[model samples]
Target: MNTNSTIRARRIADDIDALAGITEPDRPYTRRAFTPKFLEGRKWLEQAMRDAGAVTQIDAAGNLIGTIRGAHPDLGTIMLGSHSDTVPDGGRFDGIAGVIAALEVVRALRDQGTVLDHTLEVADFLAEEVSIFGVSCIGSRGMSGSRPPEWLQRVAGELTLEQAIADVGGHPLHSAERDDIKAFLELHIEQGPVLQNEKIDIGVVTAIAGITRIEIIVEGRADHAGTTPMGARKDALTTAAWIALGVEELAKALASGEAHFAATVGEFEMTPNAANVVPARVRMLIDARAERREDMERFVDELDNGVGAIAAKTGVAVSAPRMVSDNLPTPGDADLLDVLDGACQTAGASHRRMASGAGHDTAWMARITKAAMIFVPCVDGRSHAPDELATAEDIALGAAVLLDAVMALDTKLQEDI
Candidate 1:
């Protein structure tokens, strides 16, 4: 790495270490949204942005935006950022790395005494992780005017979503209608093993997978284990287990040749906890995703049919309701992808084009403006866990690519204007 890159890498490592220290004391790194630890972490980040000499503010949706003025403020701004919230007992890097990288880009620009024609804005969005309210991307969705109205009514812990927004100095009803934002770019960890396994330095995301979540319930009669004979008992847990296995089998069968398809029963629960009684009900949460719309549809169809068959064979009443259906795959803007590719080349970082299996704030930002993402490899492709990690060198390389890409976009947008 070059001397500048080495310096930036050290800075990035230091910032991550500092932020990691602001987590829940008992949980180590748990900084869920709207929690005390999460709030403390945001405060630290806001101070860091102000110390970097940028104009900072929290938006109506609780997104913390720090703007650095450019030579020609009339031109639209180039925005970059990610979220700071983490999942329960989550790792240190996932969304936090992106926010720090965006700030690093602004700091680097200041250090070099560089100013572009378009203003630069770095943001740390609120609640990008799945909240207790069963919603994700609340801040980004609010910014793009895509948030569901019911989200405001849902209560998480002691506060409703709306109240949480207000507590953070945000107006939940307000949306940012700024046409001055020309584009958005985010730098994040790959969260998968592909980049590390391939030994690639950078990953230019082409598209984000469409996610579908279904809630499956199997109802059966609760009967005394001794009284109910093995042939007479209707076991809901056994039936739900069959359906879960069926989901895996169907996904594997459909993904035989496709690389971007996945289905998992990540959440499962059973009622009537008694050793002498049969389970009365079983609830399973099914999460499925794919790169293509047709594949997703087919997978859902197969799962539905498989569940029906299992219900018939097990003699249990089964119902699979579509709880969350976000099936539109957001493709990265072509022009922005080209810019990112060029940035990778200029930074001398080995890169490959890949599709993101996980969703990001960029997907919602793409609705408002051109949006793209840069991914750096994490150790063993692990994320959302305590062991999640990325090398300082790799993180710095991704941020360098982001810096180059932002500069390229600034020039390109100016010429277009």
Candidate 2:
């Protein structure tokens, strides 16, 4: 596996088949964020990061950078990307195979001429899926300034995440305060099924769960389904289906065996226009996660006391669980997970570590710096959708361990600064 790693794994499978043919071939690989086929797949990945010579841009929260420099460009930068949007019939390699394996690790360091000393960028971020404004790493939370003025007054297609960060050229009140990037790698696609059920070929990660979400709402009293009899009916969709089966039996009794602790309700809604009316109102969302933070505060306090005892035995009137987003657990950076487990044993591959249960932009670029990730192994682990596969030899062995963990985090982050 080295004719320049089979020509960068056939140029990352021909740049993921030309960014999955810039989507919208009448749906099914939709490419959501800012739409128009996600701005023509971010203009074909910003012209494949300017034909791999780098030096591109789009910041101010639209995030599409590129750079390349290195050679002590004032020692700092060393990012890497992930996010080409999708999730609505999504998955052409979840975040487009971590933005084409970080532009094939800057086209394999400009075809091995090497360079390094730091300064390497590569991003692609914007709307890391799950957004119609219900935010999801919207451009790594606006380049880690952590954008949240009500997430620029939420919108999505009709724009207004500050007009989709100034229609992509970005500058929604400038925010690239880069304290010399330092470290940030990414290389996704382990959407789950733990390295193809442990056949393993790389997945270092090690923590990124934290999400919360919530919403709830129940109400009731639409009535008249055959003159509301059933013992004086009130049923807000049967008390939101008994609070979605008590949020899957309180996340399987608080993951008694810790199956990566989770809780979901996915999303449900029911109002007047139903096969029968008696289903006054119901709207759930829930979606908790854990990897600790006191097991996401005891699964949102046992799902807010089991939705107040299923809205007081189904009389209905819930509403009170509304923490729409939390985001805690980010971890991953014990020296970038030992420089990605020594870049998967120096690319001989076969790795393990794990954690990520979805949610990325390297968990909001690990809130500013030294982030990490590098999965690779999707197939039956599936992803947002369109049968989300992965295997141009496990995404070129996770982009050759993300080009040896970005040249060992650009020489171990300049010897720990």
| Residue 229 of model 1, lDDT score | 89
Best by lDDT: 1
Flag regions of model 1 displaced more than 4 Å: 1-7, 320-323
Q: Taking the tens digit of each residue's C-alpha lDDT, what string does model 2 give over 1-417?
A: 333442377788888888787788777777888878888888888887898898887878778888989888888788888888888876688878878887887888778788898889888888877778776777787788877667787765566778777877788777754677878888888777867877888888788888888898888888778867798988888788888887888888777764367788888877775676778887889888877788779878877887897788767788879898787888788888888888788778878786876778888778778888878888788777788788877888787788887887788777877
Clash totals for all candidate models: 1, 0
lDDT for 102 (candidate 1): 89
Against the hidden true structure, what lDDT does model 2 obtain?
0.80
Model 1 Cα lDDT, one tens digit per residue, 1-417: 334542288889999999999888778678988888888998999999998888989898888899999899889799999999999887599988999898888888888878878899998988999987878998898888888888898987777999999888798877754567899999999999999999999999988888888899899989998888899988999999999899889888867764478889988998896898899998889888777778888887888888888989989899965666655788889999999999898888999998888999999999999999989999999988888999888988888999888888888997776
Residue 396's lDDT within candidate 2 is 80
Worst 10 residues of 1 by lDDT: 1-10
